[model samples]
Target chain A: MNHHAAQSRAAYLFLTPFLALFVVFLIYPLVQSLWLAFQQTHGPSITRYVGLDNFKSIAVDRLFWKAFWNTAVFALASVCIQLPIALGLAMLLNRPDVRGRAFFRLIFFSPALVGLVFVAVLFGLIFEKRTGLLNVTLHAVAGFDPEFPWLQQYVMPALIIAALWLYAGFNMVFFLAALQNVSRDLLEAATVDGAGPLRRFLHVTLPAIRPVGSFLVLLSLIGSFQLFELPYILLGGGGPDNQGLTVVMYLYQAGFDAGDLGYASAIGWTIAILLGGFAVAQRYVSALDER
Target chain B: MTPTLSITPRRTLAKLSAACLTYAMLAASAAIVLTPFAYLLASSLKTGEDFFGSLFLPAGEGVFGVAWGRITSANYTRLISEFDFTNNIVNSVFLASTTSILATLGAAMGGYALAMIRFPGRRFVTNLVLFALIIPAALMLAPSYQLLYFLGLLDTYTGLILPAAAPAFGVFLFRQAFLSSLPPQLLEAGRIDGCGELRLFVSIGLPLVRPMIGAFVLITYLGTWNNFIWPQIVLQSPEKLPLSVAIAQLRGVYSQDYGLLMAGTVISIAPVLVLFLLLQREFIAGLTAGAVKG
Candidate 1:
């Protein structure tokens, strides 16, 4: 066979399975879903091209907006809490002198192994209004009544705590690996040049892991958008007054509960747009900081 | 020099404080991560009265006394007799194993092609895989469900296994590993020996990508085992449900039976913990592979 022909044949042969599946499952569905976003649907089947009617409905839908806002808040709160705590833990664990680091690392990373729904259930028990561990401990310590409804009144904070518990260790493992990849020579050189631990970390270590940091930020941002199973299981599918409703949960509800598949598709597309926009904006800001 | 060499109490105290602070933070963080599991274990062993009474304290009481007052094996036994937890476990393990195997095979071939072959559309395929990484699986849920329902495969293992086996992340990871680690001349040498392309891939490529395969298998297995939403939507029958879904059902039905529910939750999470402990090195490598790069 000629070289070009051989190459083509090999490429086609090797790519057959992935290509077929991608077209059938990914590409086709992707296009179909986008189309479904515009078409109005009474049930599972789309009726007609409504030309932004679904989008208009989503724009004015109170529940949809509540979920969107709740998700945004959750994402911001999680990133803020998870990143700093992860960074600190990663730094401490990276220290060569730290004893029992391996054991601590395993303990820290254990929660991520638990399924999201399981964590939600576990936290639900922990945050139970009267008999929860939190209230019980508080009552014993301060002689106060154990009546606070954590999952209901403080839904956002409770959700954040659960998110942090489920994810912080996973993030820490990432940061720890990145820290290991940082050159020890650079750190020692900075220390010898009279830079203290804080200064050296801020100026030298952070700059070295900038790529990893950026990547983590982007991944966390995407993860924040895709928040579903936890909120769905906990707080009874978005809690009291929809305080815990996330965008994806809302989309699921729209499609499954309300039978508005077209509107749900539109909501899904809107999430994609929002995530893309946020990623771009984050990249822009990071680039500006670098410059 | 002599004065610097001498240990001072003040400096010792400062160093001690630093160590204490580090240990304190680490201990507190560890407690927060582990306390929930501890509570779960404790609650599972206690009866309702003891569970309620010792909510915050350690369950110093025996497992048989207050926590497990109804000491009948009904919950555990019922999981087999009535709830089909055993069948769900089998279904989950079977689906995860099949997905892992299929995903690894496809990833090996595609990764080998990308790494060794000078093919057209290589970059295009790579970019497509990366794009798949960003497209949240949630977005695909509705269409995927409808497509499966249309295909009459909604409740079948084939439906669950096949769709997941084609994940682009596995392909991307294996391709990156092959490109970075595998030398190009090995393939050329195999070609010179008159080996056919498929044989070369099977004999040489598969061995070379074993670690990546292991990593992919663990990742894929974890994803499948912990999968909830897709199976929830697709499987209508409880018998077909995976452990994750089954556990959710148990929670829904036995909301008040904290001990039984906690036992079920513990069982659900045990496999994951075991897998993580066993393949932790590879799991960390896989996680780092996804996180440290695009």
Candidate 2:
């Protein structure tokens, strides 16, 4: 008992430095943000007990809803399009006969190395109406003159394209790792049973990698919800029409831009609740798939 | 049942067509993937006058018309001389390295304790980390700023480094690694040898967690290097801002100068790009290791 007590003390000692920092930074902020959501603040220094006024105001805020919806679209694209492309590429590259596997894998994943901000910055010009490569290519190949403001006009799709370019490779890397773990014997057995490649993939391979797939879905959902830099830069911080304002952007604008720290806290709480809902939905869906 | 000799004309033709289709798909996807990077490189070299002169063709004639343009390094020179590239790069490097080192160190110890030691409320601590994982960081944004301000840490590297040191992912990773790789007998043996707790940890625990430490370091470094929003929110001073924020601000500074902007992006991301390439395999493995385990 004494040994156990001493050991536990030592363990607690080991945990102190990290937990000290974690509680202050991670834990305290969470609790404080929840509390701050219910209050009102003029700036960093000004505070008043508002008693749910911030939340009340947020419920009627049009920009909040717009940011929510825009973020939801990004999340949807990540799951529906980005993940599938990644899975397809992984499946393709996982084939036994594919040549130059290393080269292709590296090429695909190179984009992920570039920061999201850099992607937003680089693609801002790459999609420029006049000097942009996208338009230039379209003009040469199809004899179609490009005139639309790719960033300002079609904000969501353009952002989605950039996201796909950057993240498909990232997801592909993960899926590829997951695919390699699928037992070849099981696949061969299914093949001998006259299961075509598609059916085998659907039944055997997919079932085997479902955990990682669900994990990736969750990961991408979280990633998309954290969408700030891409939209912030690409659309020049919420765009002319405010079509690109993400939830985090709204929080940022509220906190820094408007100096409404309390309202920003409220926005932060809403985002937390929404993300929690996503986690629950992801869990429920994964459970259903498991059954 | 002679399957080996079953390669009839139709079968051969089918296989060939399938291979061709596979190659075509790969090629198309590769093109889409490579286009932006190709454009980034080619345009980085172009003169302002001929920035949009030709799509694939560089500004002047010969060698894709980009030969002389590549020689100038005008954008790069301007980025360093005018845009505070060197300072920003140094700041980013310092911040990222500090955050990465601190986060990894804390995670390793915390992971070691969680994985090895019998302790009170270990489960609670573990659950707290799991909760941290689920909680959206956006929830903490306003409070973090306020907290940092009260602590007088805003706009400082300590502000960035301290908060990031306790990432749930790193904790989980180190714990998992320790659980898998650490042998309890070493601790038992060391304790019998009368080594103190701190010494035991320093001598045995440190070596056992090397793989995870390396992986966590890479991950945290990458994350810190790429981080934008929190730094954007916290660090307002140009000199203190990391590359992520500095480059983001570069857009306002050099609005129409695409070459300068691209140069900044390339320079800011260059170290991370090299590190990512070198450690890409381990990085991918570290990422998937958790999911694959799940």
Best candidate according to lDDT: 2
Docking class of 2: medium
Maximum-TM-score candidate: 2
lDDT against the true structure, per candidate, is: 0.77, 0.82
Query: For candidate 2, lDDT tens digit of each residue in B121-208?
Result: 9989987766676677787889999999999998887888889988776776777777777788988898888878888888888887
Worst 10 residues of 2 chain A by lDDT: A282-291
RMSD to truth, every model? 3.5, 2.7
User: What stretches of model 2 exceed 4 Å from their correct place?
Assistant: A278-291, B2-13, B56-59, B64-71, B193-196
Error of 2 at A136 (Å): 1.4
DockQ of 1: 0.47
Give the range where candidate 1 chain B is weakest over 10 consecutive residues by summed lDDT.
Answer: B64-73
Off by more than 4 A, model 1:
A1-8, A141-145, A277-291, B1-17, B56-74
